[model samples]
Target: MSDINNWVLPEGIEELLPDEALRLEKIRRDLIDLFASWGYQFVIPPLIEFLDSLLAGTNSELALQTFKLTDQISGKTLGIRADMTPQIARMAAHHIKKCDAPVRLSYLGTVLHARGAQIEKSRSPIQLGAELYGSQHIKSDVEIIQLMLEVLAVSAIQHVHLDLGHVGVYRGLAQQAGLTTSQEGELLDVLQRKSSDEVVELLETYKLDKKWVNVFVQLLQLNGDVTVLEQAKKVLKLGDASVQQAIEELQEIAALLQQSYPSLPLYFDLAELRCYRYQTGVVFAAFVPGFGSEIARGGRYDNLMIEQGEQVRSATGFSADLKVLTRLMAVILDEQAKEIILAPDVLDENLQGLIRELRTAGKTVIMQLPDSSKQPNHTALIAKVNDKWSVS
Candidate 1:
């Protein structure tokens, strides 16, 4: 038999104590309020759902992270949601299928992952994000990015570095080069890790055009300030229209963000594909000083609704781990201060009436019991003074 005294929590699982839990709740509420102010409505998706529905469309990455189990009643596989984006996408597809363009939805929930995504990170994370459905316009992308920046700002995280990229650049090149799906996946893996020699070797193995291969090399090299955009335009001049259009969109969005937030530093990494599988177009991430990973990440995924058999809508959004943000902010959990009044044990009508008055006035009054030995820590004491009940 296992030793009962040797208590231990499962790895990657954690419990939040009172103060920490309260602080996290406060941050969650504040962020949701902020989302509401920006016209994003909140929705809570089920913590567990049908595996197929939960991991639908280009979500292999998410599927791997999800914890799956056979449902006792239905015998169907159910997965504890590893990512809430798909659930929100389904809702947008089925519930608001006929709604207007640009349906803004926000969600705050705990998503359970099979394993921690990073070292020292929780297996369960408080995911807070807003998604924009419909409208493929670049302005929509800009809006989501700006909202992400605002979220970080509201959390009191500063010195943010925004790294921007467009997956379309690479995806377009692969399509134009006629690389098979297997080949493309391998190349993407190489590119993500930035293995330059491997990328060269893989491209050469397929005998792709040397010019396009050079463009791939440039893709790896195109990481720096806004000047890299000019470099990309110059080096990838022979890219397809899709690639060109992607570059133009990045240029416009970067320029707009620079003009809007002159102080916020922006870096362009043409090869920075955070969510290459599902994310189709412009992708971005926000990082603060001293944090090794991105504080928040999001990009355009317009095909999600269409893949779920809903009307075609262009969408883009970002999500951040609220727990990470709260920690990074160094939030000091504070208990709500209440004016607690300790009342006398005597049940005289006058004393009761005085207690009632205090209670009615939003004061917390603790009436003492005659036989009780317990005492309450309070801000004030109610006692009879000069034949009148008064607080001292």
Candidate 2:
């Protein structure tokens, strides 16, 4: 029972065995190469930082996700970065300050959040994403989406969907509802969970225009294939300039992506609000089979430049969640686990170098069987005996 409090893995935490760990590392490397080819250099923000600094402009919900503590030397509150987006923002506004416009940076690191994250999420999960600075053109939006799709395809992730959204759409709706900020937050909470009863109760709290209420409820339900957009266009009713503008953006971006990647699936969700506070515009999340959350997510943020003390310059980009991608690959590998094994059964210096050379050249060589009696974890699988070598 002493094991109960020895700082071991708590429930919902996962420890990757060698095979799974190796596979995850390989997937991370492949994604890095994918981003590198597109000219995205890498940057790794520190895992721990002064809590207030890391949360410069983030929302409360995000702030609560952090795991905090006090630094011994400074006695100031510190926390693990909940996400890399804000840190990347800091970097653009500071470290890479000298770079030219449209700076493209990618990163691969584990982000630590509160332990109460969604059941499947590891409090520590590897994130692979990018931040594109200094451009807000529609072409930039289209390119970021295109890059996300390309990474997924190159990662061998098929049978997926890219659901797009605009926080602008929701902001306009909430404003039209004439509800207080708290009321709007309630409204968003209901829609975020897709709870019709809760949404109806909250809608009743405000004497909202019945027409707008119906349209709002309908938008929450509006999620599906290309046909959903047709239904959305009907309820949207040409009233919300923001919503209409967002739709036009979607159409333009979708057209560009389809021109280049006709096979890529694309659609929209007007009520989808993942990172509501941090993203200033056009947001998209990619979901592949067998993964719970988005495999990739990013959006535009022009206002961030103003906050960064730089003149507002629209920017947009996306990142593939390496943790999710790794999990999906593990599921795929488990379904096809059979693999060839190899060994050079001599316990000598020269033989060891040969084995090392084989591995360095990308050969999967296992030194021994798992059940071997003499030094089960020994480097080589078997030893020379009578001028020959054998495994037990």
Candidate 3:
């Protein structure tokens, strides 16, 4: 027997009802306005595009997560966007490539991934973010990080724990060790899983530079408070200039952020290269007390534009799922839901004028229909009292 609930949605797909949708929309507007205040122009990329354009220069893994179909008009493959960053990158490099100064762009839209990023996450997430292009200074990094902190503040996310890492620390060491791409990939995978034994096994199997191998092992233990930088310097004593420089960069960022947010909880994880493949430099993730997964994460990916055959420029940004934040808002917020004011179905000019005035003042006024049962719960009813209309 077929259990036919025709309205049932596919797994991981969802529809927002009136209250949830209203709250989500309000957050979106507030965030976009915040971005604008920071001088970031908003851009809307199409929901779908040609496959090549969609996945160009991104991690090969993204292809599997993308939904594909044959286009009838051009007989070419089209993809529903799994991520909007690539499209925004394309716009920055091609359509708006001529800007002399760094381009700061923000976006908010629905992205359909083939599967959820985590076990019970949404397949279609409202991706909200800002991207900065054309500057490589530590100032650029600090700006994006500060902006991200501000975003969390605006969303009312409390007790945020920030985890910071830099891929350049590992990349430079890998270069010095002369490890091949496959070897680097394997090591990155082991580090991401934080498996100490596997890392040792791989290091012994490769028999790479003794100094670099020791440093690699030390990375796993390098975590916690700003003091971790000092420990990193000692642990990576044999580290090359690039490694030293990466540490210094992290120190500067930490100092600036700490100075700004004295009470902010900050952690440093040297082996925290979760998105090592796509991220070229500094990477970060934000977590609250109860959430097992990161609420938001992003980092520097300067080479993305180069892959698209455009001049390489510095770029960094962060994105959070609006749906998740909305959930959090619901938990912490007690917003008073507005009620509709019932207006009688009278053709009197003064009654109609009064309803118009209330609506213009941002009140919700619903005209009572002929059927009383169809009327909404009346918070206030407009009645004809004497010659003027009054609320009863």
Q: Which candidate should be chosen as best, given TM-score against the real structure?
A: 3
lDDT of candidate 2 over 1-392, digit per residue (tens)? 56766878876566888767777777778888988999888888899999888887677877888889999999999998878877877777764458666788788898876765677667777777777787768887887787887777766677878888888777777776577888877787788988777777778778777776787778787776656666766778644687777767777777787789777687778788867766778889888766677888889876766565665356677766565676665235551344333564446776576567767876555765456655433233444568554332
lDDT of 2: 0.73
Per-model TM-score on C-alpha atoms: 0.89, 0.83, 0.95
Stretches of candidate 1 above 4 Å error? Answer: 1-6, 330-384, 387-392
CA lDDT of 68 in candidate 1? 96
Q: All candidates' lDDT scores? A: 0.86, 0.73, 0.86
lDDT of 3 by residue, 1-392 (tens): 66779879988999998778877887888898999999999999999999988999998789989999999999999999998998888888874467778899999999998987787899999998888888888878888888887877788778888999999898988877888999999999888888878888898899887777777888899999999999998888676899889999999999999899889889999988888888889999888987889888889998888877778567888888999888776244333556568998888899989998999998888888887767777678898878889777
Backbone clashes per model, in order? 0, 4, 0
Query: Which pairs of residues clash in candidate 1, taking residues 3 or more apart in a chain or in different chains?
Result: none
User: For model 2, how big is the CA root-mean-square deviation?
Assistant: 4.2
The candidates, ranked best first by lDDT, are 1, 3, 2
